[model samples]
Target: MTTITTRTVEYPADGLTMTGHLALPAGVGRRPAVLVGPEGPGLSDVERRRADALAELGYVALAFDVHGGRYLDDIEEMLARCMPLLADPDRMRGIGHAALDVLCTEPRTDPGRIAAIGYGTGGAIALELGRDGVDLRAIGTVNALTTGRAGEAARIRCPVWAGVGSEDPIMPPAQRDAFTAEMQAAGVDWRLVVYGGALHAFHHPPVDQAVRPGVGHHPEHARRAWRDVVGLLAECLPVTQ
Candidate 1:
């Protein structure tokens, strides 16, 4: 059985207490870990499952909670909590860096080889973490709207793999093109994929049914995107175990 572990860590920012999950390969010794930033406002069973899935693939994974202990039950509430953080930008960086600290300091993680993956808003945080010169080896983002922006693209320090849906209204073709241009201009190592006919939150299969019509999810695209993300991580942050 893969050895999965979890704990609650306080992110001294805003006196927030976050409950996080860490999963490691069975018989591991300082395995590389992926610090997973939550989509917005918190951690969910889906995030935990992603961590477990990463462990199953021979890497340690830790999913951090951004919502403290408050879980939003609807889009309105979720957006309310996420808007301010996205607007401030610094709060996004602070929270992402703080989560990274919690993941790297753990004994089971290899400080030299940790990376990050995020979805939607969390993806933005992961990209920010990469741009902030954190010691990340790779970054994977799914259905991210913010990655294509100019200022953030300039700060990335490692290889980036961004997956977006062909039909995603939030991150349409124009935005993807712009983001591609920005990455090229920044001279950052990067890859971009637009899954045909897919929609937003492509990798999030169990997204609230209420969110389905608003944000489509395609299991095939999600799986493909995940495989691509894991492959990129393996290439950029090899597991030393």
Candidate 2:
């Protein structure tokens, strides 16, 4: 196993002191970096572990925070905070950019070689960053097939890859179509994968908290999605040994 380092980082976003997890690879020189976004409930051990996994793969990774170090396990509470935030594109961009700033500031990060990968609300934030004209090599999202303001997607300069469960009510066929339409109209290179028989947030491991309908885990699909995301990164932001 690669010898990696991890730490907690604090940064301000959306009027909150966001505490994120930063993971550094084993080797010395600056390496490609990736921004890992968590589900709407907020950052958890899941995302932090993903950051560590990315670090083990030789990339500097930062799993960003959305709720100021709090994890909302209640479905209603999660929606209460995420709904309004999702409605405002600028707010999402603010959070994404803040995390990007922290990632870029790391001495080991290759600022120019970066990609964004996120789940649920975090996925939406990644798409928002792409729409905001951020220079990203790639954008990979799962369970967040959100459409942006008209013409905004045209600003996205990188290839985008998205994954969703076919049975995900939150991101149903209509939402997926709309998202794809927007990306197509903008002429952005993009791809979408539908995991059959899966539900919303299928990539996430089972949690003890109560979840809304159409939210469950599929261990197999979860592994597949991670492989897909890793493949996307390898193609767009390869790490040098």
lDDT of 1 at 53: 87
TM-score of each: 0.90, 0.99
Clashing pairs in 2: none
lDDT of every predicted structure (CA atoms): 0.77, 0.96
> Largest TM-score belongs to which candidate?
2
For residues 22-141, write the lDDT of model 1, one tens digit per residue.
676777478888988677646788888888888877787877777876667587888897877776667878888777887778787788888889987788888877767787889888
Clashes of each: 1, 0
RMSD of each: 2.1, 0.7
Q: In candidate 1, where is summed lDDT lowest over 10 consecutive residues?
A: 205-214
lDDT of 2 by residue, 80-178 (tens): 999999999999999999999999999999999999999999999999999999999999999999999999999999999999999999999999999
TM-score for predicted model 2 compared with the true structure:
0.99
